[model samples]
Structure formats: structure tokens, C-alpha cells
Target: MNILVTGGNGQLGSELKHIAFQYPQLNCMFTDVEELDITNQDDIISYVEEHNVGLIINCAAYTAVDKAESDIERARIINATAVKNLIKACELSSAKLIHISTDYVFNGEAFCPLKESDQVIPLGVYGLTKLEGEQYVVSSNEEGIIIRTSWLYSSFGNNFVKTMMRLGVERESLGVIFDQVGTPTYAADLAGAIMSIINSNEKLDKKGKVYHYSNEGVASWYDFALAIFELSGIKCIVNPIEASEYPTPAKRPYYSVLNKKKIKNDFNISIPYWRDSLRSCLYEIEKSN
Candidate 1:
């Protein structure tokens, strides 16, 4: 099967490229924005047609949470409008589109884990726009799978894990928000899960559906930092603070743990816990250095 991947330079996209070789039957085409602009319907249509793409894994997104407040239009263009174009392209090619979404869709009010069917009440522009993208996929008649993940990190690109690791080496003490709680999804794990679904072809019908996935277990930003320090053997003091103590342009959800039961049952894949994935990622980072 021929698979097309967007945002090929991003964390998830880069990791997908690394593992694509493992699946010999899968023909993968990885493209960044420079090669194929997702915002342009014509570009997407041409690429899909030329490649005879059977599946589209959309990893492109406007991920600046704080900056999104000042630049809502740019965010909408990338997050919502671009996705709409992708959906249209998928419709034309009769390809299955797996779009990556985020946990920020929720307002962070719920104390328990978020299920796929839960009501959405995004608190910021970034979250709202991402949710809009998800809605567009669901409304389209094309075959699609919307996966909502949280606190994603990888060996590539900018993410919380890398940020903490950098700060641990430079600073004597780092302050992290202890109030916010969620699972830290390793991009490799998510990529693996997507590949599993594509290979199985059981859970998703031609019609579109939504699902939630993340690494097992939960942690605050503070706890996550502590784990990084412990795993990397970085001698830095991690100071735990409340969300209000560290203000940002966007309001983050205090709790956004996604329930993986549906995806687990449907795909029949095992997920590593957050700490275990962290260890694996840190180990990879160490080897690279």
C-alpha cells in the first residue's frame, strides 16, 4: 500500500520515516510543507493523484499554543483550513486519512480520563482550531481516523521533554507546573499504533471515526521534569509550582488524560507507560550525542 505523510520534518513524521523501512509492503512518501503545501487544494490533489496514495497520515499542525493567541488566522489556516483541503483530497483519491489531533480540545475541567464521545469545550484558540479540524474530518464522508493525543514528545523538534533536558543541564533549578496532569505520548509509540491500525484494517471502516491514544499513566509537568532528570542523570532541582504561578498567553487544560481503551481494544496493541518511553527516548538522545 502507498502511504502519504505530511509534515515529514516534524517529530512524528521524522519518527515515521525511521520506522517506514520495517514495513516492507508499505510504500511511503514523506513530504514537508516546502514540497507540498497542504493549504493549497491543488497541490494536495495533484500529489495524491500522482502517488496513487492509499492512505494519508496528516502530522502537519500549528503547534504554538501561546503564539496562537496573537495569530489566530495563521493558526486557523494551518490547523483547520489545511485539514479541510486534505480531507477533500482524500475524498477524491478514496484514501484513508489519519489526522493527528490534541487533548487541548477539552477545557480541562473533567477530573477523569477523556473518552472519544465526551463533549468538547476548548479554552484557547489553538485548541479550538484543532477541534475544528477534527470536526471537519468527522463531517466529511471520506474514510478518516482522528486520533487525539496529549503531551507528545520525540527525539526531534521542539517539545517539553527536550526543553526540560536542556534546562536541566544549564540551570540549577527549573520551575514546572504541577497542577496540569496528562500522559506524555512518545511520537514513536503513536507512529507504531498508526501503522498497526493500517496493517490490521479492522477498527476503521470507510466512514470516519474518532479515537484517543497516549502512553499509559499520567504526570504533571513537574513530575515529568523530575523523571527526565532521573533518567538522564542530570543534576538539576525541579521546582513544582501551580499553573497560575507560570502564566502564559494561552490557558492550558489542568487535566487532559486521554482514554486509550477504545484504541487498545480496536487495534489490539500494547502501549508503553510514559516513564518507560521517556527512558527509551532519553537513551536514544544519549546515543545520538
Candidate 2:
């Protein structure tokens, strides 16, 4: 099978690139904005036709949460409009679409872990645009898979893990938000899950299905920062602070923990604990540094 991965320079895409060698039966083409403009339906159709691409894993997204508040047009273009184009291209080219989404679709009022059947009430521009993107895929009646994840980090890119690691060395102490909570998803693990789904053939492919995936455990930003320092052996002091202490343009969900029962049952794959995955990623970073 031939697979095309969009946003190949991003964290999850990079991790997928690293593990591509594991799946010898599959041929993968990884493309960033330089190689392909997904917003251009003609380009995507031509590329898919030329390459005989069977599947598309769209990792491309407008991820600057706070910036989306001011740059709504650009966010909608990438998150919503581009997705619509991709789904159209998939329809024309007979290719399956695997669109990556976020946990921000929820309003964070739920006391329990969020399920796919839960109602969506996005609070900010980023979430709203992402929800729009998901809606396009769902409404298309296409064989598309949407995996909504939370708090993603990886050694391959700039993320909260890398930020905390850098600040741990540069500063004596720092304040982190204790009120907001979610599980940290390592891109490598998510990549592995995607690969497992791909290799499973018809078993894992559900028509217009949305699934939730992340590491097993949950943590606040403060707990995540402390874990980063502890695992990396950094002597940085992390002080817990409320969300109100530091305001941002984007209003984050207080609790975005996802329910992984469907994905786990359908795919039958194991997910590591958040801290354990963080430790593995930190080791990878250490090796690279």
C-alpha cells in the first residue's frame, strides 16, 4: 500500500518517518508545505493519481492556539478549508483519509473522560476551526478516520516537553498551570497506533469514525513540568499556579482527558503511561543532543 503523509516535518509525521522502515509492505511519501499544498485540490488530486496513493494521513494543522484568536482566517484555511479540499481530493482519487483532530472539541465541563459520542462545544478559534475540519470529514460520508489527541509532544519538534527541558536549564524556577489537566501524548506512540491501524487492514478501518488516543495517565501542566524535570534529572523548581495567574488569548479546556475505549478495543493496541512515554522521549532527546 502507498501512503502519503502531509505535514511531514511536524512531530507525528517525523516520528512516522522514523518508523517507516518497520513496515516493509507499505510505501510512504512524506510531504510538507514545500512539496504539496493540500489546500489546492487540483494539486492533491494530481499528486495522488501520479503516486497511486491509497491513504492520506493529514498531520498538517494550524496549531498556534493563541495566534488563531487573531489569525482566524489563516486557521480556518488550514484547519477547515484545507480539510474540505483534502476530503474532496480523496473522493476523486479513491483514497482513504486519516485526519488528525484535537480534544479541544469539548468544552471541558464533563467530569468524566470524554467519549466520541459526547457533544462538542469548542471554546476558542483553534478548537472551532478544528471542529469545522472534522465536520467536513464526517459530512462527506467518506471512509475517513479522525483521531483526536491531547497535549502532544515529541523529541522531533518544538513542544511543551522541549520548552520545559530548555527552561529547566536556563531558569532556577518557573510557574506552570495546575488547573488545566490532560494526558500528554508522545508523537511516537501515536504514530505507532496509526501504523497498527494501517497494518490491520479492514479490521481497524471504520467508516466515518472518530477515536480518542493519548497516553494512559493524566496530568496538569505543573505536574507535566515537574515530571519533565525529574525524569531529565534537571534541578529546576516548578511552582504550581492557577490558570488565572497567566492569561493567554486562547481559553483552554480545564479537563480534556479522552476516553480511549473504542480505539483500544478496535485496534487492540497498548498505550504507555504518560510519564513513561515522556521518559522515553527525553532519552531520545538526550541521544540527539
Candidate 3:
């Protein structure tokens, strides 16, 4: 099977590129915006048809949360319009799509783990646009999968894990939000899960389905910071503070922890605990340094 991974230079996509060699049966093509403009429908169709791509894993996204608040048009184009283009291309080429989404689809009002079936009420331009992308995939009748993940980090790119690791050594004290809580996902682990789903014989019944995937366990941003410091042996002190203490252009979901029951049962894959995955990612970072 031929697989085309968009946003190939991103955190998740880079991890996929690293592991693609392990799956010799599948021909995986990785492309970034410079190589493939997902916002252009013609480009997507021509590339997929030319490559005979059986599946597309769209990791391309406008993920600058705060910037999206001011950059509405760009975000809409990338998060919403571009997704529709991918969906249409999939329809034309009879290719399956696995579109990645975000936990910001929720309003942060719920205190429990968010489920795939939960009501969505996005709070900011970023969330609203991301939700729009999800709607495009869900409304399509073609074979598509929407996987919503939270607090994603990886050693390959700029993410929370790298940020904390850097700031911890450079600063004496850091303040992190304690009120907001969710699971931290290692992109490497999620990449493995995506590959597993593609290689498995599990059928989707020709309908679009949404699944939640994240590392097990949960923690607030403060806790996540502390772990990074501890694991990396950084002397920085992380202080816990309320969300109100630190404000941003985009309003983040306070409790975006996702429920992974559906994905766990359907795919029969075991997820690593958040700390364990963090340790693995830290190890990767250390090796590179």
C-alpha cells in the first residue's frame, strides 16, 4: 500500500518518516508544504493520482493557537478549506484519509474525559477552524478517520517537551498553569498507532469515524513541566499558577482529557502512560544532544 503523509516535517510526520523504514510492505511518501501544497485542490489530486496513493495521513495544519486569533483567514484556509480539498481528492481517487484533529474542539466546560460523541463548542478561532476541518471529514461519505489528540509533543520538533527542556536550564523558575489538565501525547507513540491501524485488517465499514488517542494518565501543565525538569535533571523550579495568572490570545480548553475507550477496543492497541512516553521522548532528545 502507498501512503502519503502531509506536513511531513512536523512533529508527528517526522516521527512517521523515521519509522516508515520499519514497514517495508508500505511505500510511504512524506511531503511538507514546500513539496505539496494541501491548500490547493489541483495539487493534491494530481499528486495522489500520480503516486497511486491508497491512503493519506494529513498532518498539515495551522497550529499556532494564539496567532490564529489574529490570522483568521490563513487559519480558515489551512484548517477548513484545505481539509475539504483533501476530502474531495480522496473521493476522486478512492483513497482513504486519516485526518488529524485537536482536543480544542471542546469548550473546556466538561470536568470529565471528553468522548468522541461529546458535544462540541469551540472557544477560539483556532478551535473553531479545527472543528470546521473535522466537520468536513465527518460529513464526507468516503472512507475517512478523524483522530483527535491532545498536548502532543515530540523530540523532532518544537513542542512542550522541547520547550520545557530548554527553558528549564535557561531559567531559574517557571510558572505553568495548574488549572488546565490533559494527557501529553508523544508523537512517536501516536505515529506507531497510526501505522498499526493502517496495517491492521480492521474494517471501518466505509464510513467516517472519529477516535481519541493519547497517552494514558493526566496532568496539568504545571505537573507536566515538573516532570520534564525531573526527568532531565534540570534545576529549574516550576511554580503552579491558575490559568488567570497567564493569559493568551487564544482561550485554551481547561479540561481536554480525551477518552480512548473506542480506539482501544477497536484497534486493540496498548498506549503508554504519559510519564513513560515523556521519559522515552526525553531520552531521544538527550541522545541527539
Q: Write the per-residue lDDT of candidate 1 for residues 1-289, one digit (tens) a residue.
A: 8999999999999999989999999999999999988999999999999999989999999999999999999999999999999988888899889999999999999989999999999999999999999999898888778999999999988899889888889999999999999999999999999989988877464323889999999999999999999999999998889999999999999999999898888778899999999999998888887
Q: Model 2 over residues 70-159: C-alpha lDDT tens digits?
A: 999999999999998888778888899899999999998988899999999999999999999999988886687899999999999899
- lDDT (0-100) at residue 10 of candidate 1? 96
Residue 115 miss distance in model 2 (angstroms) = 0.5
lDDT for each residue of candidate 3 in 42-155, tens digit (9 for 90 to 100) = 999999999999899999999999999999999999999999999888889999999999999999989999999999999999999999999998889888799999999999
TM-score of each: 0.98, 0.98, 0.98
Clashing pairs in 2: none
Range of the 10 consecutive residues with the lowest summed lDDT in candidate 2 = 200-209
Backbone clashes under 3 angstroms, per model: 0, 0, 0
Worst 10 residues of 1 by lDDT: 201-210
